[model samples]
Target: MRKIYITLMLVVGFSAVGIAQEINWLTLEEAVKLQKKNPKKIMMDMYTNWCGPCKMLDKNTFQNKDVADYVNKYFYAVKFNAEGNDVVNFNGKTYTNPNYNPAKANNRNSGHELARYFSVRSYPTIIYLAEDGSLLAPVIGYQTPQQLELYLKLFKNNDHAAFKTQQDFQAYAQAFKPEFKN
Candidate 1:
């Protein structure tokens, strides 16, 4: 009985060591507030409902355990819909799509002006921002968990500030240490 009890305790403890929940994705407003307190970088998954790559990113990339753990620890993860209904308060004013046309057959809405402000031309443009809501860079494409991890660390470490051009950043990204190698 003593041996069984000890074995059970060890199993439970080991299980607890690597268990983690889903990504604690935040709203833009909440992200800003958390940033002020924690001073970490921001990773925004700018998405739309009709986007295929956006869904893929959510299902495969954001759902991965390593990705979730790293993002939750080092960045304020934000899921911002390009055509969302929530009013965004930024730069001293609120922004929303006042001219959204619901009658159109396409999935277009009068997208949130903030999306336009950031010049997001694609559905799943991942925007990395500073703690103060300033734009760092917008990565436009579908990134697997491993691919996203490199960019996350690069921006988190402020390596982007070292680059003089996109070519320089591309060189750094090519040499980044990915999380899945372990």
Candidate 2:
């Protein structure tokens, strides 16, 4: 009975060791700082409090175990409030939401200068950055786990550079098979 109990506990502990239920999200600055020593792509979720799709993305897509695990392995995840009043420093520049209204924190607030710098006009945008903290691209709106796997693989592998035309991307998208569970 003692051996059985010890074996069971060991199995459970080992299985849980590599599985990720939640993403370890960091600030953009933190991610960038870590990138200097350990280079990995940064995936930023640009969201606002008022955006319904942003909430859904958090609940449905980001909550998936496979998505969380993949992100934790290949990228440094940053959850940034696109309309919040957080001061940010990036690429030798400082950014802030100078027009942010405290009363409208839950409603429509002023856009952050960082969001403007990234040209994020929509909520729930997934902004991908290179390992060196350079901008890769922005995937706008909500995405399911399976749907998001394509972009995750595309940027992680730097395959987006091969697409020289819209038709090229369309062809690639058509042939792509998602391995992530929904």
Candidate 3:
């Protein structure tokens, strides 16, 4: 009976550990507020409900333990619906989806003003923002765990500061050895 109790406790503890290894995503407002208290680069997964690649990114790259841990540790993760009706206040501007159609919520409704402000033309654009909430870059498309890991580390380490030209980024990409597996 004593051995069974100890084994059960160990199993429960291990299960809890597994459950805890996920990205702690926050709302845009929450992330912005938190940055004021504890500054960290913000990573926004700007996606629409109708995007197929966006769904794949959520299931594959974002779900990877290594990717989630690294992003959670170095950046305040935000999952923003680019077509949603939520009003976002950033950099002294209020953005909203004024043309959002409730009847076609799942379809490609008009994008939010925030998405247009950032010039996000594609779905699943991961927008990286500075600690002060300024735009760093917008990485468009679906990336595997290995592919996304490179950008995560590059921006987190501020390695992009050294790039003087497009060639410089290309060189860095060529030399990058992705350590994360899909």
Candidate 4:
């Protein structure tokens, strides 16, 4: 009976550990506040409900254990609905989707003012921000785990500061060796 109980405990503990290995997502406000307490870059997934590629990104890349673990360790992850009615306050200004129609919420709707602020014209745009909440860059499209790993590592290590021209970024992309499996 003692041996059986010990085995059961070990199984439960390992299962819990597996289940706990997920991205710790925070609200925009929460992420900004946490940045003040402990400095870390912020990664915001600006997506709409009707976007198929956005859904694929959530399922295929964001759900990957290696991607989630790396993102959680280096950045404060935020999932923002670009067309939703969430009011966001950043950089001493408030942003809202004043023209957001509830009936068209799931379909194409006017995006939030903050989305316009970042000039996100497409879905599945991953916006990277500085530790102080300033915009860094917006990577548009559905990026696989291997593809995003490059950008994650670049920003985390502050390698983006060295880019003087578009050619520089292209060279970095060409030389990047992806460490994550798709």
Candidate 1 — which pairs collide?
none
Give a tens-digit lDDT track for model 4, residues 17-102.
66434789888999999999999999999999999999999888998888998999999999999999999888889999999999
lDDT of 1 by residue, 87-173 (tens): 788778788877766563247666778789889989799999997889999999999888888888888888888899979978987
Q: Model 3 clash pairs?
A: none
- Model 3 over residues 1-182: C-alpha lDDT tens digits? 99999999999998886643579999989999999999999999999999999999998889888999899899999999999999988888889999999998899999899999999989999999999999999999999998898899899999999999999999998899999765
- Candidate 3's C-alpha runs over 4 A off are 1-20
Question: For each candidate, C-alpha RMSD in Å?
Answer: 5.2, 4.4, 3.4, 3.6
Error of 2 at 126 (Å): 0.9
Q: In model 4, what is the error at residue 143, expressed in angstroms?
A: 0.1
Clash count, predicted structure 3: 0
Give me the overall lDDT of model 1: 0.83
Tens-place lDDT per residue, model 2, 4-90, is 999999889969764437999999999999999999999999999999999999988898899999999999999999999998999
Q: Which stretches of candidate 2 lie over 4 Å from their true place?
A: 1-20
Report the alpha-carbon TM-score of model 3 versus the true structure: 0.89
TM-score of each model, in listed order:
0.83, 0.88, 0.89, 0.88
